[model samples]
Target: MARDGSVLGMIEATEFLDIPTTTLADLLGREQVMDIGIRPLWGPVPRIAGPAFTVRCPPGDNLMLHAAIHRAEPGSVVVVESGDLDYALAGGNVCAVAQRRGIAGFVADGLIRDLAEVRDLRFPVYARGIIPIPGTKAAVAPLGEPVRCGGVTVAPGDIVVADEEGVVTVPAAHRTDTLTAARTKLAKEATETLDDWEAAHRSRIDEILARGGFRG
Candidate 1:
């Protein structure tokens, strides 16, 4: 199920980071990065950070995922853990519902369908694989509990970031602060001052070295 109202305050958590999920993994101490059998349904985006509104479900079961759509806040990324199985748990229908609910995108450890439709809608979905067959929603995986997915331990409300590099999880406490810093860092790089400096200096680091230091 998706988290709610300061439970994890996912809506608030997303305002913090600037880097892609892979970079967050680097910042998060290289916790674990898993690649599902499938590929990214969408391209990389700078709006890649979001609070982890999670959905854990039985392999091939999708009831809880559907339920999560209603609860997840807009701009939040919904993570669906399907026990690393190659079974389809979601697809275009769910994507449509999630989009209607204003979710940012999807990250599934299992499978999904309707890739073309999802792409046409310009929705983001990362998954293990795509199957023509859909799963039956017969069981529920524990929500708000930590579950291992794609090599990372995803706790409810943890900061989730995803881009072309794939998905990464950041600790909850650091979500707000760390991402804010990253945003600052990204902005400074994007500034005109930095561009002028790089153009003039060509090698900005060499000038810093010339400015000096302790003798070795």
Candidate 2:
């Protein structure tokens, strides 16, 4: 039997500072990062940041995703655990409805169909693969509960950040502190341009590499 959890209500969009996934990955550093294999299916170099509305579908069935989209608040990202690679849980039509509902985007551990239309619709979607095969809407699964997605645990209200790099999850409890740390790190980096700094430190880098047994 599948289980569902209570929706925690949506985290305010303003709650998410505009921090890039790359910066978040460097700061929190753990399974907080999803596997690199999950790539954007379409949209421009997207930067999606929103509270997670997690849906765990039984393998090959995505009925609960419909519920999740209707139940999710505006600016929420529906994170679905489709549990396999063969079936597409949602595609362009679903995405269009989601977009109208103010969904920030979608992140799925399974597949999605209608690539050209999905891209044409300009919805930001990230998933493991694409297939013409559609998912059946017969399984009863959990929505708003903690679920494993793309190798990380995602809970309702957890902040989801996805970009060209990949998706990263920041636990709801740690988002404020993580955002603060990421901002500080970004501030410091703004002063340290790397282009010439690396060149200037080439000799120092060579010395360290030599000690590590790298022969040039």
Candidate 3:
């Protein structure tokens, strides 16, 4: 896992953004664990990717997130695992600070608030849902540790790619190979999209129909 001081070990956001999350998830065999339910809250661009700064907060507590926003390296995406739900863990004020500090974005397994204000600030945030009620900040949760968010276990250094579709994480161990394979698959998909359907068929239409038990 990459820590706040270990930016050199993390992949650049540009590389992750180049390949869409759908391509990565598909190449990874539709592994649902690779993706998160979190959707983009707001930004000029609906896409963001960067090394994760994993944080674990108990349900409605967001003290760790507040600390992470200030401590995490610039360009790092703050990933929080909110144990429960029903309260907003982050809001526009914190997002404004994160953006000013050069943070890439935010992803939470819980809820957040200040949707209009967050959009007005042009900051990127992804979370399970939104709520008007804010959470308690009394708890001081751990940061830079491994945690599960959106059904996937994320380490501090894992690469996160998110867009209008959703968020997908690439384990640090698989980052290089994953990106390479996803790029290859994306290229193939592009060609397949343009090639004539008839030219790419492996069998005649009659043979296909016959296999389907159709006499016509």
By TM-score, the best candidate is 2
| Residues 92-180, model 2: lDDT tens digits | 88888999998988999888899888888888889987999887888886567898898999988888989888999988888778878
lDDT, candidates in the order shown = 0.70, 0.81, 0.79
Ranking by lDDT: 2, 3, 1
How many clashes show up in model 3? 0
Candidate that scores best on lDDT: 2
Question: TM-score of each candidate?
Answer: 0.74, 0.86, 0.85
Error of 3 at 14 (Å): 2.8
For model 1, residues 1-216, the per-residue Cα lDDT tens digits are 333554346556556444656445555566646554435866543355666777888866788887888877777778877763655777788899888887878877777888888888888887776777877877855556676667677776677777777777777777667777667666765676866877768557666776786233
Candidate 2 regions with alpha-carbon error over 4 angstroms: 1-17, 199-216
Candidate 3 lDDT over residue span 1-216, tens digit each: 435435654445558778887787786655434344566766445677888889888876788888888888887889988856788888889999999998888988888899999888878888877889988888975689998888788888788888777788887778889878888877777777434656556357767888899964
Model 1 residue pairs with clashes: 16-179, 16-180, 17-179, 34-150, 38-128
lDDT of 1: 0.70
lDDT-better candidate, 1 vs 3: 3
Sorting all predicted structures by TM-score, with the top scorer first, yields: 2, 3, 1
